[model samples]
Target: MATVVPEESTASTEVKAHEVRPPRKPSASQIAAARSLPNNNEAVWPAFTTKLPSSLYIDEDRFDEEHRKLFMTLPLPLAPSALLAEPGSFVCRDGFGQSVILTRDKDGKVHALVNSCRHRGSRVTENDEPAKGRLMICPYHAWSYDLSGKLMAVPRREVFGELDKSELGMVKLPCVEKGGIIWVKMDHEANDDFSHVSDELVADFDALGVADMHMFALRKHEVEGNWKLILDTFLEGYHVIRLHVQTVGPLYEDTVVQVDRLGSHLRQTSARVGFTKDILAQNEESVDDLRRVVTYVYTLLPNVAFICSQDYCNMLVMQPKGVGKTIVHNFMLTNVNPQSEKLRQKWEKSLELTDGLAFPEDFSASAATYQGLTTGVVKELMIGGMEVAMEHYHEMIEEMVARA
Candidate 1:
């Protein structure tokens, strides 16, 4: 059954609502820090190269611009129902900070809704609670909306005054699910259609040969850097030899990275290290179990990274927390092994191992880069040849922000 994600369950609605709060007046020290922050206008564009500036890692203004231009305007893709694997399944994503309700309804539709109620604006759903049937009742004002977001009933509309149910339905974002991914435009005009964003997505994810996988394990953490910084960490494998020497460097070819672009979409590929001999000696029959494989890394428009491997896959989603903070979600998956408990355990173990290995390295690099970039030591950034993919990503962002 295809899962329909209701509008409020979308990540964009969740994150934006979460981002909406009374702005905090900066304290004296904070203001001082901001004023003292480096502004190397001359260094903003370095000589022709492939390496981006370390300053970009922590620029306050640039970070703010990204929030307004990228997240607020661009649409991000979500995991599809095929990825959810079953009815009654749901994942409570911390959309930056907003609570987003993602569930497979009884009719097999996926619903992404803001957890807030339409009446008093209180959070209506918790992270894991599932609402069944054709309607969802707000826990706060008892206002109820149907699966399609129509205001079905309110407790005292007739007694107090006839409320306009037609205008009180939950807000819905533009969303479409395919290829085991759900995609939504965050702040598009009401009539904007997002289904045409990707030619490949239009063809369907299953048709792309990457469906039927179930999440084996999911891990998330808070990083003290902009979401772009966290995303950039995964954009190129150039740092593998240096930052991830103890982990990924041992299994990935850090020197060679390839890239492709589709409008705002981007893709990269890196040769998975550690098993060249195995692949050379193995026949087609043994391809599925080989440890080292060519990994396909892709970013769909805004901020999603996916690494599809032979037997399993991994996704790293970057959600912004604020100007200089981000929340990272790492989901590792594999085809559901219906008959073997050992295989399932292996999948779980692989996820734990990968997460434990990669996160510490990424965090340390991102934090250092963030702090270092805050210093006004440089003018322009350099994006060297090795990190061309990352450079392309920044170029796309710059173009979008400039237009916005």
Candidate 2:
């Protein structure tokens, strides 16, 4: 149920029953950082002529380097924070072939731990679903750990001889909950922080009120395409008219969008036909008007894509598997009542539209492009100005990989 302010309230103070204050918009500097190049309505108009190397997308060596240089060193956005609402709640995640456990202990503090048990290195937790219990017991030996990753017990202490329980706790990873999502820097040896992720990104993250949202639905799908290619599909609105004609195209501008870059992250906001019409009619030229009336896609570098609408936040975490495949996790975060059939159905329609379009059209293009590139038929692909975000992304990848 949506919050409502009582009509009788005075101008000085009027609080809604369950209302929440909208999050701050991007700072002026942040906005300037994310601004994209100007583009014509054709959506395919020319801008910069930077050609991405064909091998960059399908090279096996490059894929392995990405795991080490990008995934391992970056502050990755995992699942949303809603999964940790309960004191003993936990969720497991698999990234870069490593298993991780994210838990909220009895103290209501969250911790990220490597899922492997200290004694035998067996996975102490499983992912793709939520789990809750006082102890996360290793199913192999009944060895257990507390939510904070503290060693609790070993079934037969005498059998262990002189082993120290304190020194054998689950390996804790450097993790923090930021922007309504859990972020972990995958370095097991270093005490790295998410400082490099930019305060601009985190400060602007809750713009859609994702911090208070609960998961409406979550799914994992493997697409037959390089992860970068899959992400490229979301960076531009050039294909909306021809590619998404039957679904979301008619509701949005035929061409034209603002693609901004905040550090390495890209925020692309497309003009909505219906909503844009209203703005033109009213002759309203507020600077923030475009943001208030369009769809926003924030591509968080290296992996996560945080898609935002006024009422919904769909976080897509693209986990690269091989040169030819990517594991995509779609997390639907919403404020709607989960138990209400009517509410859920309304929310589900949006997801259905995405699957219908992604599977048959948008994503298929990426997969096909990867196939073509692998065949050595193309030397490189040109990214135009309208798709400036794509160029920005490639450069960031190059810079990060080099820095590492």
Candidate 3:
């Protein structure tokens, strides 16, 4: 079951703040990016245009290559650490074409185990909900395993002569919890080195207090589009003013974003509508109110996009199911849990605005783009200078796929 935060009515008209950790000052790199953001009037088009073949989105061979080389091999973000914050808690996630059981042991160590039982191949956990217990009892034969994937009990063990419990533990994948996200490599033979999750990315997430945030809600979206096409939405701001004009466009500056590359990952910082260069000039050393003026979008290569706003962060894990299908797991994380009615209402409203209104706009655009490409009339898609981030993203993907 989904964890629920208790909401109580408050008599005070003023909003009471929830208990949270101290706000972190913007990192040096983040502050520098903020200072370098171009004003709306100073924004200029890119000097060159890049063209990507439509086959890249609709071709089965291209999709299969990416699936094997990138998605299967890399350390993909599975879920927020907050989801398994409590000891003995577990959550089942099947977004990456694999049923994974994420658990927090009594000692608070996180583990990613295959959901299949060692006995009859039945799923140990039957549903995708946050559950807590000492043992994960398989429904097939009541075979149970501990939170760390250690086999604990088996029914009628004497019936099976010389059963080896030690060798029958659940299969564990290479998992690491960093920057408040759980990352797991899907392929058993893939390299376990997590060097691809760079320190720069962790520092940025740490500065944003991503590790300590409370998970407000998580929802799964089945999008009728390629995963890369869905990711392209967050890589560029060119579509905001045009595509999101009715929803969130009025709050953003037109095509003015500061793009920075952190190894394979990418970070985009853009000023909000009322933002001015003077804000950076006043706060030279540190950005006291960074999210208020600037929106940070970090793309963790292959499958994750972490978008930061003033009150909460949106972590999107786009799992490609096919050339034309993607499963997007959206997680909304807040600095603190909503303890009062006012706070609860505030978060609910934010969730409704983004998930209900804004995200539909972005998702539909990706679907429409996919539909158009599938018709085969358009041989190539044009990438403008303002959307240079998309070019960088695609290049990084191609480079990773080329690796031996």
Candidate 4:
């Protein structure tokens, strides 16, 4: 018989820093959640049902308000640092409804520029793919800017006599690189203070080794649903045993999740079928892989979802195209580059399991749910006990929207 430990017994014990920890170990919150894992016969559930208005998902006016208040004001994690691994590399992205260029200067500093030329207002580089170069020259008139967005050269410099180069630089957005992710605020006038990104969230990501990972694969999907709906699919495990039954269902325990709030953000940990308390009792210095026994999902509120698997991590960036449209960018990251053909094939297989099988199931469900909400018959969506994290998520969004 499996012995069930009381939640207090595990929750009260502090995990010391001096103890030898496992590689790519759990964050402090994750450690606590792991310690409180319920036995096979025991179950955990939310205490109340959260009522969310259908307008939150289908009303265009409400969507516009959210876009203005939350999306425009908050700092969003836009891209993986591995996307700009080499100095002088850059990628043009328009997922946020604005054409922006992310570049790493020769000195290895990252910058987010408006992507338009200072002179003619044309995009400096149109290529969406990652490329390496020192200067971004506008094809319109050959005006050029360096990787740092400094207007370096003008073909007809003599034509514009007394023009100040310093005042002609491209519009630069505030950017910060932390936890191997590039966070950018869309409002150029907003202060550079990123205090909204809490220390606990960064420490959790650092523990997951996101900074040193390799960008294995990236895929973008356009879904006919609100961006929040797409994000809701990742916040709970309630549907895994139902919606994903044919694919990833059997691997996860239904309604067996541990959720902790990291400020406004959330961290959800779930044990696999074979998980045992003994897994957590192993010597911290031992080479045991925690990912084998548990899975971690980090929701960096309002936009990103980071899911950790045994081998690779999936980082999903949900960009709202409209009230009922979204562009979901999925990035698969691994600890090491897949140099060998065999290794590349191995990761490819994992991608197919997610991007191919499991993800489509969630996307389809979100799209269908949005379609139903648009009919105006359903006034309120009930968030049940199994989806408590999602309830907290919506509450945070409501608070931010109201305050902003």
Candidate 5:
């Protein structure tokens, strides 16, 4: 492990960390909602029906608009903070066709920068080269930039008239580390705000100890489907029995879910089919009990999903690749292993089972839906009453796109 960097006077770090509050336990009502889902069988629904136009998924112009107006403008979720554990650690990603680099500086602050060079617009960091806190030198013209995005060297002085290096740094985006994940607004302008995301919801993520957990795997898979098609799997339980019958079918119920909306985000907790009769018989269950007892699927609308099970959490970032393609980046996190071999194998087997069985089912279904959409059978998508979260997701996308 690298030495922890000291906190500095950086604006990005100061603004995010100051207002965060300690996490509070979930209320009794939340516990009841999770536990009683199978009993009541009623999912929370929106005020009106949501009908999604088919062109939103198939048309190239709408897809491009979604990328520019929604993805670039919204605070999009990226990798876990664990990936940047060491100072100078960084990750490269693609945002709406722009190559982005998220790096943690020596002062323990994370920054998002456009990866192109300031002089010739060439990439600063090569895929094979190390891109730590050291200077990022452009391959095209040898222009170098420091970790704080300041130009350091231009090679050969007085080449093209008088030039100031201070104004020629990499393009900086507004990025903040919160809820154990890093979020960046790629097209952030002055006075940009992410206050639409509720503080209580962020605190809910904190209660899960997302930042403190160890990240075991980071996998990226390309789905041959519209981004919204991929989100349906994360937002609804209705497809589990049909699409995931062989993999995770035995573990979850269909059409029975507890839905909660936190601003643009939504949480769907379904009663596990495997919840034994023994656990429910206990007289009193604690506030933190439902998480371990039920299956939770949270969709941070626009482009992210976090699914939590008994032993592990899988969070995903869906980036639009084209009108009918999406790149899904997922991070799997779990508790650190115990000293004993038996306990170690328990977590190991669970993660292995999840990796082997669950994800393939999801990706295959996404591809199937993508191919099916090209058939032109359905002109619009009908969001049923049971799939309320999916309805909420579609509505939110329309609202944002309409305003944008």
Candidate 6:
């Protein structure tokens, strides 16, 4: 018994609805087209509303910009005690490209130097093990360098004929061992002292018991993505629900995490909503009686993550391989106490699981984003309120990139 509306009225209503359509979602090709637009610095604040040119991620010009702007003057780490595990054990690798060499002198003093030798640029040490005692011979030629990067001997030194032997030593970089970690400054003009960054990070570093930690898991990964993109994944907790759905998603709350800025350094911790206590109580028999019950996350200046739990810690260093690639060094550290085998194993396993899935997930996500960006498909990326830390990070990059 319902009456039908008039055809003319129905047609008029349909026409009005058709006239009002929501904004169209931009396609990948559309995004690329948007990149052709002019540079808009105004879009960099809360959201970098305008997508940068795809070339920024793949072009040689953009890579050169990053090299000159960011990597040209990076700080170098150098400290014998920081790199030492036992009385005289040490290890080191390249801060930027492919290079690493470890040496333990006869006096129980350890020196970690770059692989390249001073005499005609030959690699001094092999990749197998730390060279013992003083003499280290270069692989390319018979040139040799002493423990302190001194020109110990050169094949047919007399034939060189009046060449200054003193000046023909390996080029040493500015480095320091602090809080159980070797830090090398990459910039030649970098300040000799690291008191500024150290003083700020000392308390947190001590809290992790870094002074007594030993390296257990040392691994490096090469991936296709900007180093910052990989770093950004670790800097915030906003992506857990989306990116780490199966792994860390259940452990952290997307909205309740904390982010604190210490100068150029960043520190953060996730609230477990009583889950940490629950996990501890369930595994009380396996965990030690006197261990920290809280999970801590910290990021030191430049690029280092000190993720520590009650039993052990993980130290990660991310180095930019190129504009679109990065090299990551993941280290497992434990307490000096030899009796904590059970506790150490439990902690190490937790870190292993977390680190294990993280890189793979991030690699996939970052590579996909890079493809879209490089293909000229996206004009802008939109980050929301939960990703405030990420926005802050990008803002700082903009400022640094724009300076000078």
Kindly list the per-residue Cα lDDT of model 3 for residues 196-264, writing each as its tens digit.
888888888877878888999998889999999999988887887678777766655564677888867
For residue 176, model 6's alpha carbon misses the true position, in angstroms, by 1.9
Model 6 lDDT per residue over 9-31, tens place: 22222233322222223222212
Return the lDDT, model 5, position 376: 90
Among these predictions, the greatest TM-score belongs to 3
Give the distance in Å from residue 352's predicted Cα in candidate 2 to where it truly belongs: 1.2
Q: Roughly what TM-score does model 3 have, to 2 decimal places?
A: 0.94
Give the distance in Å from residue 373's predicted Cα in candidate 3 to where it truly belongs. Answer: 0.6
lDDT of every predicted structure (CA atoms): 0.56, 0.70, 0.81, 0.79, 0.68, 0.53
* Tens-digit lDDT string for candidate 2 (270-294): 5444443535334223223334445
Worst 10-residue lDDT window, candidate 1: 1-10
lDDT by residue (tens digit), candidate 5, 1-404: 00001112223332233223233465444555565554424434334456777787788888888887887777877677776767876666764778887888888898888888878788877552224657777878888887778899988968767998878988898888888888778773624587756675676677666776667677678888888887777777666666666655654554366678777777776655445435644422432345555666778768888887644577878888898888888777754424445444555566555555676677778788778778899788777666777767777788888897
Error of 3 at 356 (Å): 0.4
lDDT winner among the candidates? Answer: 3
Q: After superposition, how far is residue 192 of candidate 4 from its true place, in Å?
A: 0.7
Order by TM-score, highest first = 3, 4, 2, 5, 1, 6
Query: What is the number of backbone collisions in each predicted candidate, taken in the order shown?
Result: 38, 2, 0, 0, 0, 20
> In candidate 1, what are the lDDT values of residues 1-404, reduced to their tens digit?
00000111112222333222222232222122222212222112223565566545566676667777666566566554444556655544557345655656556676666656778787655644233455667777788766656678888677758567898776666666656776655552434556436664333234323455566666777887767777777776657766766665554443344466654677564444332433423422232322123344667656777765545667777787776677777766654432355455555555654677666577667767676666767555556656667778888877877896
Q: How much RMSD separates candidate 6 from the native structure? A: 18.1
User: TM-score of the candidate numbered 1?
Assistant: 0.75
- Name the lDDT of candidate 5: 0.68
Candidate 3 residues lying further than 4 Å off, grouped into runs, are 1-13, 282-288
TM-scores for the candidates? 0.75, 0.86, 0.94, 0.91, 0.83, 0.72
